[model samples]
Target: MLRSSNPLEPTTASFGATDIPRKPNYDFERREREKTKAAESAKKAQAKAEKRAAEKGASDADQSGGS
Candidate 1:
């Protein structure tokens, strides 16, 4: 058997994902994106609310102690 001289060539699998046909669904994709964004926003808001509550409690304690 003859050996190949160019062994540095990249194979098809090394080029990343395989070719696959996908149907474009703009409405579905938009809804999914909106859901993800809303969930993230809600998580951030909850964390912010908790932080604000903690800060407010600490401030109240400090004020009452000084009185």
Candidate 2:
């Protein structure tokens, strides 16, 4: 019987060959990141708008009370 020097090489003929793992999908990962980023941006924008509206309302009330 012949023996392979490399440890990675399968020794026995009866044993099935090992399948290599699939490579990472960079495009899919990038798209997912972009989606999360867009969602966060939208959320921040909404909060900012709400804060601006509240400040505007407060100022208007203050002006009316002062007059």
Candidate 3:
């Protein structure tokens, strides 16, 4: 015999989730600072590489026989 499911019944367990201890001093500001620094460094490196490539292209064009 098949039993009918109760829609109102609690399916999951009521564990002590909210009872978890939090950090005494969370340095989210420091994490954001580091993230921004890393992003800026990457952007600078990308720009430098692009500039070098453009210089190289100009030099190659100058060296080529045909204009």
Best by lDDT: 2
State the local distance difference test value for candidate 1: 0.87
Question: Which structure among the candidates has the greatest TM-score?
Answer: 1
TM for candidate 3 is 0.56
RMSD to the true structure for each prediction, in A, is 5.7, 10.2, 6.6
Local distance difference test scores for all models: 0.87, 0.95, 0.81
Judged by whole-model lDDT over C-alpha atoms, candidate 3 comes out at 0.81
lDDT of 2 by residue, 1-67 (tens): 7589998888899687678898999999999999999999999999999999999999999999999
TM-score on alpha carbons, each prediction: 0.67, 0.65, 0.56
Specify the poorest-scoring 10-residue window by lDDT in model 2: 10-19
Model 3 residue 29 lDDT? 73
Order of quality (TM-score): 1, 2, 3
Better of 1 and 3 by lDDT: 1
**Model 2 segments beyond 4 Å from truth?**
1-22
Query: Residue-wise lDDT of candidate 3 within 1-66, one digit each (tens)?
Result: 333398665555653358678775548878888999999999999999999999999899988956
State model 2's lDDT: 0.95
Best-to-worst order by lDDT is 2, 1, 3
